[model samples]
Target: MFTKKVVVAYNDTDLSNDVLDYVHEILEMHAEIELNIVYAYEHPLENPSPFQRNYDDGAPEMLAYAEQIIQKAKNRFVDLPNHVEGFVYDTGPAAAILSHAHDHHADLIVIGNRGTRGLRELVSSVSRTIQTKSHIPVLTFPKFVQEEFEEEYHK
Candidate 1:
């Protein structure tokens, strides 16, 4: 029976899908609440090395990828019980999520427990930072639970 707005930190991951489905279920039960779906991105700093120019610019590609992800999410929840809004930011995922929640005065922040793993996990500073620094209430779902959540929602 929470009336506060909920913000979901979305990314192209199984956990993100779970967070979305959980938010959808919450919305179904609390029709007065609002939902915001956010995808965050951070561009790599320009390197001084000559080979740096050959590397793909992360911002534009990430933003495009985020848009596609958002579209897919929208299609998946086309008949959602509550209206959902999508947001894309070209900044660090944790920072963007925290900033957005503060700016929008969100009551809850939802995200996946982990997105990358092994070697990639070591490089994911944003998620780590969010987990440590965010002041708002945060809910994290494991990847396996996300799959079950999606199946339940789709069925």
Candidate 2:
């Protein structure tokens, strides 16, 4: 019986929806534990590290996109238990997620594996860092889980 809080790192992808479904299932089985849905954003600083800065210097546009994504997620899971809280943070995805989990004292962190392959996977520094640096348990759902869900639904 897992009693500690559970945090789900939600993006606006189908993979995120699958993770939410898994969280919902866990909630059904373990009603006592708290749950939180967190969405990460890439923040902008006047003098960001070279690697951290985006080409457009469009922090406002990025924040607007994040808000849209978060709103969609909130609407999708609107009926979650009151203990569940949704959060939006303007920090790099991996750092924001890890920090939120740590700050909230979450027992479990859940996210979707984006299924980056070959060269794509090698270039994903943030994802690799998160996997290595997280202090708490992190669970990643396979990318194909969404396809499986779609197939089941269509049948």
Candidate 3:
């Protein structure tokens, strides 16, 4: 009767891909697990590039990109017996993750951490905030793990 409802707060980062692979490995062992793969994207306030003519144009593109990432993750684990759902939100990553976990009653959250500093701190704060504010368990992958995984994959 053991079960786990996991929320993987994924971005397009390499570390996030590694985390997804780890979750896939786990699912190979325990089939009684469910995944809510959520992606949060924040639109930059800056003016659009040559391709994007307006702010509204960029927002839809960002949402589509986020959805694509979530779709790839879902496809990877589609053969599993458990359920897998993908969600995309315009809010901050930490808030989106926490809200999704709470609403879905997830047992744990898996996030990729780069252990950043400087300006990156503003972006990386999502991992830290999830660790602090989440009522459920949180698992984070460090840069070292990402590097090792990358090295192994390239070999």
- Among these predictions, the greatest lDDT belongs to 3
lDDT of each: 0.76, 0.77, 0.84
Q: Write the per-residue lDDT of candidate 2 for residues 1-155, one digit (tens) a residue.
A: 65579888888788889888888877767757787788887676777677866754787888788778777766654565536777889877788888888998989888888777787776674456667889888788877855778899988
Worst 10 residues of 1 by lDDT: 48-57
What's the CA error at residue 48 for candidate 3, in Å? 12
Clashing pairs in 1: none
Candidate 2: minimum summed lDDT over ten consecutive residues — where?
73-82
Query: What's the candidate order when arranged by decreasing lDDT?
Result: 3, 2, 1
lDDT for position 112 in model 1: 83
lDDT of 1 by residue, 1-155 (tens): 65478888888676778778777777777777878888877665566467677555665777678899877776666676666788988777888899998999988888887556777766675565676778877777755755778899999
Predicted structure 2: lDDT:
0.77
- Write model 3 residue lDDT over 22-105, tens digit each, in one string: 989888888878889999888665676777666565677787788888898899887788788899988888999999999999
Candidate 1 accuracy as TM-score: 0.75
What C-alpha lDDT, on a 0 to 100 scale, does residue 94 get in candidate 3?
93
